[model samples]
Target: MTQPRAVYIHVPFCAHRCGYCDFTLIAGRDDLAGAYLDALQAEIERSPLTEPLDTLFLGGGTPTQLDEPHLQRLLDLLRSAFRFSPDIEFNVEANPDGLTDAKLDALANAGVKRLSLGVQSFDDRFLSVLERRHSSESAIEAFGRCRSRFPDVSLDLIFAVPGQTLADWQHDLQTAIALQPNQVSTYGLTFEKGTTFWTRREKGQLDQADDSLERSMYGAAMDQLAAAGFEHYEISSFARPGFRCRHNQVYWNGGEYLGFGPGAASFDGGVRWQNHRSTTTWIRKVLAGEDAIGDREQLDPEASAREHLILGLRQIEGLNVAAFETQTGFALEPLGGEALSRLQDQSLLELTDDTLRLTREGRFFYDTVAADLV
Candidate 1:
């Protein structure tokens, strides 16, 4: 088995939970920060990696939300846990609110090369609807601060709010592009099951944007961002030249990675597993010298092949035919040619001399194409 060269550490502490979020996170849980770090250290010690990591990502709840001392400790711990390649892409996720200047300084001094700021929107109204704690002014200010510190910074934007118009969504995109971020990710709001938004939507108290409007908003993002020199690298991600997110690309390209902390999933040796979703439970189990894993999945060869194809198509570069065969030991045609042929006829997929990728129309209907392939 090949050694994993990518790592993801989830910090599950947040000041407040958003109504639309269903991620594993504990709100108002600073008290557990110490114990969480202790458990995280112990987890790393238990299965230390032998290979130098090429990329390390600190994701969250909100990693930057940690107090200065705790945040420093977490960064130091991670830095020491692995032997990193000198060019490692060290990235961290942060929220705009409560990310003080001191905290930003701490991040810069810690060798973090990239920052993914959760600005969500530059519109105060949408921010309120999304239950974000930051105002539009503050988010822009925070982006400037982040840009000053990191060579590469990514902005997150959301569109298609219940009452949001196409013009409003375009304004948000314009605002983000004006900030000159190294990368941008745009997503349409979705009401996931078990979230407050979901319950409200079910009870008819909260309305979702119509499908056509949502599609238009997504289309606008692609057009506007592309015109501004951002490469539409993936369905939801864009990057300037030389600024693609390496950590996420690891997953999309089906490479192995190590994950730690609550609800963090690791893919290694063709088996994937996730730590306990509850932060407290993960801490207790690790402290008690027991396993913290709460779930595991071992994909069969056929299932794995399908997944590889699906994830590869998510990227605009699509799948290089020879490379896919070499890596998966499965010819593309036998595995998915019939389905690809059918999609090609509909102009939803394109099969070139040595690559297979989603066509412009196919990207919008990716779920349908993936369903057929699966």
Candidate 2:
């Protein structure tokens, strides 16, 4: 197998857990960070990483949750494992409340060029509802600080939040654009199972925006952001020219990547595997010189081809007809011609000589389109 061109290191430490988050994380257990780093080093040392990496991403409960020294150490350890492309887009997830000047300095010194801040909203009421620790003012300050040192800064926002109105979403988008971020990713809030928000919703303690309102809010983002000269590069992502999140594109484009740390997943040699979700279990296994992988799936060629088609369609570019055949050794139309015709008849899909792209309405029903095509 070829060497991975991208890497993702998960740092599952959070100062405080948000009510809506279902990510693999252990909030308020900052005390265990050192042990986690040690395990990370062990995993790194055991892996092979002789080729240069094009992109590197640090995601977690919050990578910025680590103290300066620990953060520095973690960055150094990961950097040492791979040869980096001269212009590697190394991104780290950060929160406004936990990013200190010292941490910024450390990140800069370690060659981190991108900061993807979790500024979920600029509305104080929404922030409180989401249980975020940072206020609107603080999040704005954090973006300013990140821009001072980083060449590329991205912001993550959520729309269709409970009790959110179209006006509220418009204001949030306006506020985000005024900040002039290199890129913005807008996601509709999801109440995943096991999250506090999910439990509250089930108990009728919390409510979600109506489906029609949710769709309208999303459509508004696409329209408003486009008017502001942002490229809707992906379904949920907008970027100023040349400012796309290359690291995430690696995943969206189905590029192979290695993942490290607890709850991280790696795809290599046609097999996808995940690490132990429990930090303690992952750390103990790594320290004991044992495999920390908990489960894996070896996908067959047909299954892999289907996945490629679905994942590729998620992008605005959709799937290139010729390239699809080259990659999967199966003509896409031959495989799903009937389904494609059905979607086209509904005006949800269109074919442009070589590219099969989603129409404007299809963007909202991408999941259905994906299922049908696959």
Candidate 3:
């Protein structure tokens, strides 16, 4: 197998946890910042890098939440651990509130070339409901500042808010486009278990948008972004030509990557492992010179084949059936027979001579289609 070319570093600190977020993150506890960086460095040092990383992603809770010194220390450690490729795409996820000029400078100096800002929505009401700390204005300012430093910038937006109208969602899309970001990701709201939104919905305090309305909101996003000259490369991601997120593409394409930090996931040499989700436990284990991984799975051929099918379908361009078979040593026809037939009957999928891709309607219920195949 060739050396893995992607690296993912998870920084699991947040000023406050969002009501709907389920990603592994801790609220408050700024004191642990140094220790966390130290632990992260230790983990990176212990792991081997077989090649200069072509892509590196610093995702979070919010990577920008770390103070300048901590951020620098973390970056310094990464620089020491791996030789970054000359054309490497180093992406860091930032929340608007944490995107100070100093932090942005630190990121640039650390060789970060891309920024993914969590702009959630341009509407203050929706932002408040989502427990987002940054105002839309602040997000705009942050992106403006980032543009001066990073070559590529992406904004994340969520549609299908409870009580959100089509016009409101359209306005959000327009607002993001106005920012002129290199890329934008529009997502529908999902109520994950254990989230405040999930509990509220269970108590009848919150209601999800109707399925039809949500679909319309997604459609509006696609129409608007496509009009703005962004390529809808992935289902949720729209990018300018040549500005697609290479690190993310690695995951969607089933390429190998190494992840570090609490709740970070890694797949390399056909093995998948996830670090412990608890910050305290992760720090303690790493400090004790122990592997912080909690669960490890070596995917069997069939499971790996299934994962490729599921992940590949997420891309708007889909996957080549022949290439999929070669990767997994299993034919796609037999594995996806019933599911593919049903989706095709519904006019949700189209199979050309060698490729399979989603139609517009299929993209909307992609999860359902993917589940049937799995």
Each prediction's whole-model lDDT (CA): 0.91, 0.90, 0.90
The digit string of per-residue lDDT tens for model 2 on 187-285 reads 999999989999999999999998899999999999988998899978899999999999888777777999999999998747899999988899999
Model 1 pairs in collision: none
Error of 1 at 192 (Å): 0.3
Q: What does candidate 3's lDDT look like per residue over 315-370, in tens digits?
A: 99999998999888999888887888889899888898798999988999888888
Top candidate by lDDT: 1
Alpha-carbon deviation at 181 in model 1, angstroms: 0.4
- Where in model 3 is the C-alpha error above 4 Å? none
lDDT of 1 by residue, 73-185 (tens): 99899878899899999999999999999999998998899999999988899889999999999999999999999999999988888788999999999989998999999
Q: In candidate 2, where is summed lDDT lowest over 10 consecutive residues?
A: 246-255
Once fitted onto the true fold, the runs of candidate 1 whose alpha carbons sit more than 4 angstroms away are none
lDDT winner between candidates 1 and 3: 1
Off by over 4 Å in 2: none
- lDDT of model 3, residue 195: 96
